[model samples]
Target: MSRVRIFGIGSSSGDDQAGWLTIDALLAAGLQCDDAMVIEKLDRPGANLIPLLDNTAWVILVDAMQGSGPAGRIQRFDQKDWPRYTKGLSTHGFGVIDALSLARELGRLPSRIDLYRIEIGSANPGEQAGDDIQAAAQQLARCIAADLIATLLQA
Candidate 1:
């Protein structure tokens, strides 16, 4: 089982690509992942995400979100904060909260789960992510990298 797993979830649409871009940024930043650590990008995994959460000690999920905030605004959510932030929000169809709730019910959830959302202004098909979204992805990648380093040290 992997000790740490980071998943970037999104689609190919405009701002929806924020999660994938964050994964790209993380890779470009040269955050090395040994066998104990797994990093991947998933295209709107939804309920499919539940299976990936199995047997992981720590999990971090990144996705694009549409909120009142400006595009590229980043929000971090812990497991306890899901209820407050995820109401009536569905990314494509099924959402992270739904998958996570199922995982928790099935006893497959990791002890530590962190969710990072990048606010998006649009998800128009085939368009590239905006400059602001790209910048936020890079910033979030750096933050996540630092957090991973600290977690690894403590472990």
Candidate 2:
């Protein structure tokens, strides 16, 4: 079984792509799948995200969030904090929180889940993420990498 599974969820629009960019940042920084961990980028997966949670011991979700704070500010949320942070985290009609709720209802949720929300300045179509958002993504990737390393060491 995978020790950890990280999913970067987002769309092609500007800042909304924060999640995907974070995933890219991780890859660029030399993080890769091994027996202990796996990473994937999901394009607005919505309800589709539920099945992907199965059997992972730990899960990390990365996504863009707006109105939560200043652009480029990153916030971390665990499963218990989802309801309070639901706003502006979704670029799709159905979002990460929705998927998690469904997973919980179905008893498919992992024992542990960590969500990283990258505050976005704009999610305009056909545009790339702003500099601040990109920097946040890179920063978040480093943080997650460190957390994973720590977890692996403990294991």
C-alpha lDDT score of every prediction, in listed order = 0.89, 0.89
Each model's TM-score, in the order given? 0.96, 0.95
Clashes of 1: 0
Model 2 Cα lDDT, one tens digit per residue, 81-155: 887778665677788899999999999999989998988888999999999999999999999999888988887
Candidate 1 backbone collisions, by pair = none
lDDT of 1 by residue, 1-155 (tens): 88989999999999999999999999898976787988899998878999999889999999898887889989898888898667524456788888998999999999899998999988999899999999999999999999998988987
Question: Where is model 1 more than 4 Å wrong at Cα?
Answer: none
Residue runs of model 2 more than 4 Å from their true location after superposition: none
